[model samples]
Target chain A: MTADLHTLTGAYALDALSPEEAREFARHLTECDVCTHEVAELRETAARLALAVAEVPPAALRARVMAAIPEVRQLPPPGRVADVVPLRGRAWRQRLPYLALAACLVGAAVAGGVAVNAEHDVDRQRTQAEQQASDLASLMAAPDAAYHTTAVHGGGNATVVSSVSQARTAFVYRDLPKLAGSHVYELWYSRKGSMVPAGLVDSGRPSGTAVLAGAASGADGVGLTVEPHGGSKQPTTSPLMLVSIAG
Target chain B: MRAAAREEQPGAPRPGALETLLDRVSRGDRDAFESVYTAVAGSVLGLVRRVLRDPAQSEEVTQEVLIEVWRSAARFDPGQGSAMAWIMMLAHRRAVDRVRSAQASADREHKAAVRDHSPAFDEVSEQVERRLEREQVRRCLGQLTELQRESVTLAYYRGFTYRETADLLGAALGTVKTRLRDGLIRLRDCLGVSV
Candidate 1:
């Protein structure tokens, strides 16, 4: 009689719900314990996201936005309003950004921390994501672990099958997406030979050949990670892929 | 600036200044544009900075948003909503565009690489008391449930789409929307913003 947790989780956090469904469930929220707890988790998540954004424009931006409005055509001037009653509240105060901007910024970053999931298919997005997390975590946990890369879908559409070469002791990605504009896939061999970084890969998918120092051939397979428009000389974060030459 | 900490504040939400000036600017009312510029440029700028992480890009988007405010001012219908919401919408859209343009990684990844990003929300929160709109937002957020408050703030300030919020929190999307709506309603009540 009861919907499962995934259904509730997906429905609440992802809002994959239809309009009617959202309204129907919303009515139930007042009585549903399942709904209340889940909603809280989602809200906290939301706050962190806002924190991710770092920019805060000065008041001057608003002045520019307002100065551009044409009251004569849109409505009478403020003094000769047709409908509005020229109401500006007393609580209203204007000065400059203070400590609140800083606190909200923290809240936003944590909320926005989850950027984008590489996959969109419901099944893959839900289950594969969990498995990938575990796999990455296990690899990262290894004391002797070297550099790693998380599997990335190439070209935004193509599937980069991340498979292991059990015999050769490395991982290989097939169907890598084509590079775009100034962006290219960079491969990093681990630093200290323990998952630091190796190097970069050219547009080697679909046709061209690409290489990663293959130095991790004995340790953990070289990992492929995304950097800036141009690849970074050193690894900035963990790789998207982690394959043992024999993995 | 805080000298008037005890004095009553003025003109927090002025009505109808934007559209009139925008229309004039569209019709070559250079002086009107400047006046409108003087009125809400600060709001637009603050909103833009809150959304876009890159300053150069923020300035660039701000320029485009302002230009669009002028160029598209004719399409604005004051009857439907206040001119303020319309401006916020434009600024919001531009900021969203900038966020999307960045390569999205998992939320946890950024948590560790947090050092790479610019000012944190905590820092912004600290400076907010000095801001007019931020103060309004704080009062409004206070009305929401802890969950609802967080949900709405994340959506607007962090520039997250609903789905991202779900994944990060491991919660349902429907919950995210409900909380957002709840929080927004509370905020609207507090700030008296129509939308």
Candidate 2:
């Protein structure tokens, strides 16, 4: 007489069955959604039991694990790497709507009298701007990156490339009025009603980029406000630009 | 900055935070890997210790399991299970492999010596029973009949195959199988774990 395969569920869940028996159960599992769900739940329960018994590990273990990490090779991310195409060539130009919007802001900046002075300085700024563009292109190319463009309250506009999965954000701005003395543009990530400082951006440049150390996953949106040079711990002025990051 | 963020929560880690960190770890983020290690190492060590009953051996197995996590993190699919589950599954398998190999005879001898020196079984059972009262899963495990619990604990926490569990518990293979099934069913219900 054949043994009932149903009796093997617990054994299978706990991984106690012999390899031959496990193979038999695997065959049975394909046709049985009930068994599949049951096994999943039982395994989760087993895992919880493991979690419940958690004790403090040796303090030295952390140091050991951290020390070993760099020596170990990480698995390559699954799927084609080419699927994440870098923003280059035609792809770069395709974001021209944003570029055009930024161009308008640049015109506004020139009108706002943000002094584009010496030819040498102009050439240096152009090089910096190109570098910033390339940086923004790479940020946009990241698989998790999302782009958002928002108009500055008065005239210009800003673009934010954020990746919650990467816990990083790139903020690019154009045509915004530069502040004099000890003043800078500060980025803030707003969640609910509270805002946290993300990073600081130079106010002198006609267009500039800044990478912030924060994740967009939980943030309601991003905001930009003028802060004292070296940046303020809190926003002392209203946001000049606000962009909703959440869908 | 991260230390300050962690200080706000103290020891209470957010649910699904490990999953998020593992995603980052898979992408080869060293900071996230360190955070994930700090978060889960305690539980990993605890499970390994419980199975091996040898602190030194458990530590070795725990290291191997964690190193495996680093190597194979890209294969982890959140759609299948929680990060803790995935990590513990690796820990359990490694711990079991350690205790089931030729080296296990030495472990068994060590356990025998410890058993000889230990107090009566009743005292150990009472202590275990008292400890079970504090945890939901342990409390559920307490509800199982003595034999069912023995069969399950032997096959599961002790990493014994059904045949080995039967030999250890001095029961037939069929009896061990049935008790394990019935015991797990009760555990699933008592824990309110949904299928």
For every candidate, what is the interface RMSD in angstroms? 20.5, 15.3
lDDT of 1 by residue, B75-114 (tens): 6554334444456667766666566654522322344233
Candidate 2, A147-216: lDDT as tens digits: 5555677666666656555555677565677677767777887665466678667565655466654565
Each prediction's Cα lDDT score? 0.43, 0.63
DockQ-derived CAPRI band for the predicted complex in model 2: incorrect
**lDDT accuracy of residue A110 in candidate 2:** 21
TM-score of each: 0.39, 0.55
lDDT (C-alpha) at residue B68 in model 1: 74
Per lDDT, the best of the predicted structures is: 2
Task: List per-model TM-scores for chain B.
Answer: 0.73, 0.76
> Where in model 2 is the C-alpha error above 4 Å?
A1-3, A27-31, A76-247, B1-16, B111-134
Best candidate, DockQ-wise? 2
Candidate 1 lDDT over residue span A159-240, tens digit each: 1111222111122233466665755566644322344334444454432222233333444234465555545554444444
DockQ for candidate 1, please give it: 0.03
